[model samples]
Target: MSIDRLFPNLTEDNQAELERFGDILKRVWPLKAKHREKLKYDIRDMSRGLTTERSERKIDYLSEARFLSPYLTYFLPWNLYRMSRLFTGLELDIPDGSEVADLGSGPLTTVMALWMSRPHLRERRINFTCMDRAPKSLQAGLKLFNAVAGENSPWRVRTVKANFTDHIKRKADLVIAANAFNELDWSGRVARPQAEKLAQHMAGATTETGRILLIETGVRLTGRIIAEMRTQLMQTGFKPIAPCPHVEECPMPATGQGAPWCHFNFSVKDAPTWLQTLSAEARLEKEGVSMNFLYLSRKGGKDWGAVRIISEPFKFHGGRAQYACSHKGLTLVDHGEKQRPLFPGQSLVPNWPANPKTDLKSGALILPNTKEKR
Candidate 1:
């Protein structure tokens, strides 16, 4: 079926342009794709190839070159929106006039998006230092920054091609590691080791109430990774600021649900030519699911707990009612309570309760969050 038939009065050229839009957005980061398959290998290479101090460093310049692979092209169009939404619930206390250093700022998409989202912050003396060892990734980030913000922007931006191994002496109000931790698989077992180092770097902020958001990718919108993050942060000084509410970890996915039980997917509005054609045949087989794990701890919390992981429900605009839930993960304590806003379609469709309603908080869904799991 032709798009012309679906959307009338649209010229063939307009339809073609629309198709081109979707095509470009579908591309994934090619270099990351290879890294994903052999993440462990990449970590090992980094450890063996570079000096001990440099190899264990927080930021690396190689990530940018890796992102340049053809696979990453698909992420161009909606990458900004996706990342912004991912970090939406993050309520960090980044002080005014704070200079932020985005360590391992791959593609600069998130940094640019952050600036764009908080235009007011740009007005203040907020200097963003994108530190990474990868020249190609940093260059790409700089290009994106320029595209979003023309030659004359109040925000001061700089891209560093050096890794963070005592080479630079600058301290920042806030330090972040965006999507950089996932690269540990690129080298191997070093992912955990590298994350330990990165965690330390974020804690080394120069300003008062130093804050950090160790954003981890969800298995689409599931909460498992979030749990892992909580534990990792506890090992350090970090504590849970908030849960990536979109997909909070639930008990169902791990124990109750069957294989491939839960997943998530998004609509590609301007799908490129191939996708436009393929999407017609591309029935909604399953949704693309992911979860976010966040960790934040101040100077002294007395004692800290291990981070917990949970599986969250998938998120999207409009879909069938059935796709909106999985109660097998809900804890017994909150099992029969009034539905909170977190339940899917709670806002739109009223009186809809989670099926079975037996998910236990003990299982990754809810942890000892004195801060109330948001």
Candidate 2:
């Protein structure tokens, strides 16, 4: 069975709201057709500032209308779609009247994603504090959040103009930072120290039942940073709640040359056609979105003795294979031609052999458990 079968809720009731939000973005965008060319140009510049060119690090999106408009209309909605999909799959155990905080909340992207993706949360009264250094961004985000939340909503939101590591006065039940920390050390040279510092701040901001979710673009350096953060948090009594099966040292190599880091991809085929068109017009057409994320909690959850598929299927001479991480270590799981292929990030407790054979090409131990996984 594939991932959708194991998690039935994944297939149902997700895309409709996302599509509606796309329409909402279209209606709310300030720029008209006459500004289409300029919007595309701004989008290109935003892309360069974000993904490339370390010299453009000081570029501020909220301070300028040209950059902020593209960010709000194109980048924000796309990120919201990705975040909503991610939130849909996780079982975040938030109670009624829980206090939540969003760190480095660029236009409240994570909060909005939780609101849209997890409708069950809507019934519960939530107090949210969103923190960011940019006051204009916070103001704009509040406007957009209210427009989406409408009247008489059970949730209350407040904005704080502060740095990412600034002290949050109140500890929250859930803390979120999405695409936030990567900006601190973009070169990946000091990921360890940066992660350690971030872990300290995050630990101080959350309680015993608190859960912390951090997400970043699925590049190699970001993966290393996330993994390093995971190690730092685990050392401080936090435990992995998702995407990681064991508390043992991370098997995915983060250092050295030509090493493959762990990350997952979500298809954008289900995204609204208008959004896709808009993306193409901006010359940033995306077939799928990829991210590196880690969800950690002080309180432990069920321990699934399983292997998480980390990569898409690659074909060998006799069968197909994919990279997986488990308590044993990084593994290469081989599937017979007749067996169903597994999806990335899907976990299963496989029937293990006493002594697994190693594959020469991938340098990972081969798991021959080609039998149908539950």
Candidate 3:
């Protein structure tokens, strides 16, 4: 399975649909011309806060109009776009009338993405409970969701003004916390008490056959936090479904000094041009986006016999190479003749030769799997 098979390629039709969604967003939340001018400054400030000054102490920025407006206009659509890509890649097995819980759901971004990406679930009656600490953001999200959903929508949405750490009242078929856990600060250490607690809360809220999806920014610190949570969740009886071919110890060393973290990068070429202009005007141009994610279930996941590519293609000895993780742990895959280049987040199933060579620099097995196909 080439990494291309794992994600939706941006066909012309898909690009048109994305543009239409962007139009819908503008229609639902139109800002005055002067308001747009001020929004850029607000976006710059918020971007700085999220990336540079990510302190452990939490702030209610969602409640402030200055922050909330820019967030809804700029950050919300970008996040929704990112989530749509993720949803398209996933294989959701939700039943009719299933319940979904979105923790730290700022303006129902994940809920909207699920609805847009998975049209097959539109007819089914799904109950969505969005939990957040900011009432203003929740209210804005509810209104926007209703406007986007329009009349006679089968999905029911309700808002709860509470923190994500609060105990969930019911077990849901799917529990999603996109960009939520990154709010919890970490010390870049492998072991943290927060990961254990968050895993417990997520586990408690998931049904026996349900699935949980956690997404965070693709940064070194966030990678360490997710790696720790992966261990914690496995100890709590959950198995990772995606991004991990085998449940063996993660070989992407997300800890220690200057260790490389595990994450994936996705192309943003399909994003609407208007959005790109807005982002550039705000001084935050995004050519691509990166995320560290984990999808887990109590029951086992897809039949696993493939190598998941974790790093981008890099030059190796005058040839192309990529870092992949498989049952054999971390590996350096040397591209073979006529083999298509593998991108991050893609998986490849190859016939491994006996006694593969080992790379001295990275200490990873070298697999010259050429002419391999799914």
Candidate 4:
């Protein structure tokens, strides 16, 4: 079977609805079992304070989410939650085929799937790296890449064991941070170290399209996170992209259903098949995985801000996922959609003329609907 056939999407000419169906199926039979439930608990880890004057004390590469997925969000499928970030972050035109790096890449399978599915990026020579401190997780991530993408994947896959807390490594064109940040055990942040490490990489890295992607579970942390995230990324010289919320003293203020907070919930109807596929595909075989997430980001060199629209429908054409999301706060119809500058600090729209042009009044948001024609 052609690789593209396995993963689906929506398009202008043809739309596919079955892919969402497939994603939903996994919710019923999550591959992780109780571990999935455990991620939901907000309390600290039970395995902390294990050090003593005996037997090389070891902490699982986690301060929390031990035996759990970073932050438990049973509402949405974990994979889908990550995918939605692209639209929400206004990173639609991520310089196709550009070099991309995934810091603290966990179990490369999922991210690899993302790379393989994006044909536009495949044509570009991809410089890929996965860094993590845990040998087990790194090893698992390695195996994941090989299994998910056959033997002849094009991207250059490299692994390294280093602390994200310290400065290290050269950056690539684009940097990716999955759920690695929130998993830290340190006070202030479980993931802040990783973010700082990423900044170090940025200092040394040469990026044609300088950009960073940070996606995390968005349940309890939803309201709690909005402002803090904006501040941290700003410290790194980054701004929020469009189709997202302008949280950091955002100047563009208006009255609307506050940029929709994206939440991912597995399709209650599609869980069984997803569970069965996991056994043959990834670890936690024959189980389900779900995550409700909120993604925020500013595209490279853009002053535009963005906040994910929770619960947006995935529309397909023919059978491909062309138009997968519809950002909130903005609309397909611009007949006086009241343009509002994202923030008062905003001088002019950033990256204004790229593939994803922005309308100031409506703020940076998805361009009309991207849904495939049925």
Candidate 5:
């Protein structure tokens, strides 16, 4: 579906709000030559993964504006687009009047994305609770929410000043965390235990039929953490909904005998003018963003013999190879001439033969007569 169909009035509203935000930045911080130079340096540092300590400090420096400016102009659009793709791909059945909660809701970006994805919910008395440790960030998010949803919107919104690791008081119909899991230092000695704790909390905070969406940067460590959490959550009674067609243990975790990590990339075409300007200013490559995501629900018994493409299709002389994950395990499927190209995140239903040949050397499950459609 098109963006206009999925999110009525979102593009127009977003453009107006972005202009207002830009005005605020110009009025409050007036970008001078020195500021521009510092922003360039900070952007360079950020590209090299050297801004984590500065981000944790929470001090309002010029470098911070350098970061926040692009976040509003560039990152926000990409995030909304990504969330829209997830919602559409998963085909989630979110009930009307559902209560939604966002953890680490910086500037309430995810909440905005949710509202944009389900514009019908605006008339249904949905309740949203946004939680974050940064009060200023929450305040900014509230302003953005007001701008997008309006002051007299049917949706009731609330903000909380609390860290995500702390216990939450209320249960919700849908819970979303974007880029929050990767910040928990899950690569340390406490990785497994921390993942288990997070899974328990997510399960506790969701209703029986409610769903949880976790999105992280498509990095190896982040993918590993999500894989570990998926195992833990499944053990606690939740089932994988999207991206994974089966509930079996993830075969792509780093701990699983040096297997490749699980992550996917989505293409972004014709980015917004603001993002293009910011990219040029920061001297960052204008490439499509890669995101690692998981969707889980308390509902179970998904036994469909479906497969999900987990990697980019590798082209050969006259065929293509796709790595797929299913209940059986991870295996590559080779397609013959004139076959359609497969992309990551595309779901497929393959017509398997009564007797198929499996190549153990390459771990390829050759589907000679398989009729596949995405």
Candidate 6:
């Protein structure tokens, strides 16, 4: 089932808002037929900003409604879907009346995803603050938020037109940075201290019992930057909550000798038709959405025994081998046909036999013995 289907009513409501937002964009930025043909090219170029040179990362068209229209139609839905998956998979326990802050919250994507994922919080009097460096983007985000959240909603929405890394001064119960952390200068050649400073700031801004979430493009450099940030935050006493089973040093970094970085894929089969169309027109992959994310908290109480599947299962003659990471370290686990299929980001506790009479079916094994029955 699609992630959005988990909350049918809420998903419908969110879709309605998305349609309304799209309509507003079209009316505000009516494009001529000739200009419409160039949208795909424009989107293609804009998409390259994630890995392009720092000077080329800025999309000046972001301030124009004409460009923003296509972006909203093509990118927003998939991002929302990814955010929904992240929130659902992590299963965060945000309390009632919590103050949530989203850094680099372009067009309010993360906030909208949060609302859609946790519809129960709509009536709980929450405060949502969105900060971005782009004034126009913040304005657009505010409009989207107001359209989705009517005047009667209990959410107190606020938008700040400032760079989140420099202007954020208040603490929040839940802090999120989506598709923004990679913008910080962390290239191998340049050692920008801003990356560590931002991590420290986020760690310090989180309230006790609060959680911090960071999402970035599922690319090699972004994954490495996230791993470095994880190490920095861990040194400051923040423990990883998801995608990592233990608070030890990250084993997979881009600098490692061909070691795979941490990332996950979310199926986008249920994305809106408009997004799918634009994705096809832009010649982008439409089946799966990839992202690298980290969830952390000051408290450390994760189930260390639960191991995370880090790679796809490799099928053999009578069984499969899956690479996984656990508190102990990385291991290749052999699984019989009776064992459940393992996907990336899935966590399972291994049941090892201590005696001859112990039942192995009660819990899955991390690595099955070669002599064991397949």
Deviation of model 5 at 261, angstroms: 2.0
Per-residue lDDT over 1-374 for candidate 3, one digit per residue giving the tens place of the 0 to 100 score: 46444456554544565567667767777888898778889888888888787572257778877787888888888887787777787777567888899999989988877776777777889998899988889888887777766778989988998887797788998998888877765764525678888889888999998888888768887788778888888888999888788888888757776566788888898887888988999989997888788899987567557888888888787778888888898888888545656878788876688888888888788888676656
lDDT of 2: 0.78
Give the distance in Å from residue 356's predicted Cα in candidate 5 to where it truly belongs.
Answer: 4.8
For candidate 5, lDDT tens digit of each residue in 87-131?
Answer: 545566657678888888777778776665655556778788888
TM-score of each: 0.55, 0.93, 0.93, 0.51, 0.83, 0.82
lDDT for model 5 comes to 0.67
Model 6 TM-score on a 0 to 1 scale: 0.82
The better-scoring model by lDDT among 3 and 5 is: 3
Q: Candidate 6: lDDT over CA atoms?
A: 0.68
Could you tell me the C-alpha RMSD of candidate 3 in Å? 2.2
Candidate 3 global TM-score: 0.93
lDDT of 6 by residue, 282-338 (tens): 998677767888888888646546566666677744878666555655555666766
Would you list the C-alpha lDDT of every candidate in the order shown?
0.43, 0.78, 0.80, 0.39, 0.67, 0.68
Worst 10 residues of 6 by lDDT: 1-10
Residues 312-346, candidate 4, lDDT per residue (tens digit)? Answer: 23332222111112223332221122232121111
* Residue pairs that clash (backbone atoms under 3 angstroms), model 2: none
How many residue pairs in model 3 have overlapping backbones? 2
Model 2 per-residue lDDT tens digits across residues 85-153: 677777775799899989889888887878877888888899999998777777887887777777778
Candidate 5 root-mean-square deviation in Å:
4.6
Better of 2 and 5 by TM-score: 2
Q: Sort by lDDT, best first.
A: 3, 2, 6, 5, 1, 4
Candidates 1 and 4 compared: the better one by TM-score is 1
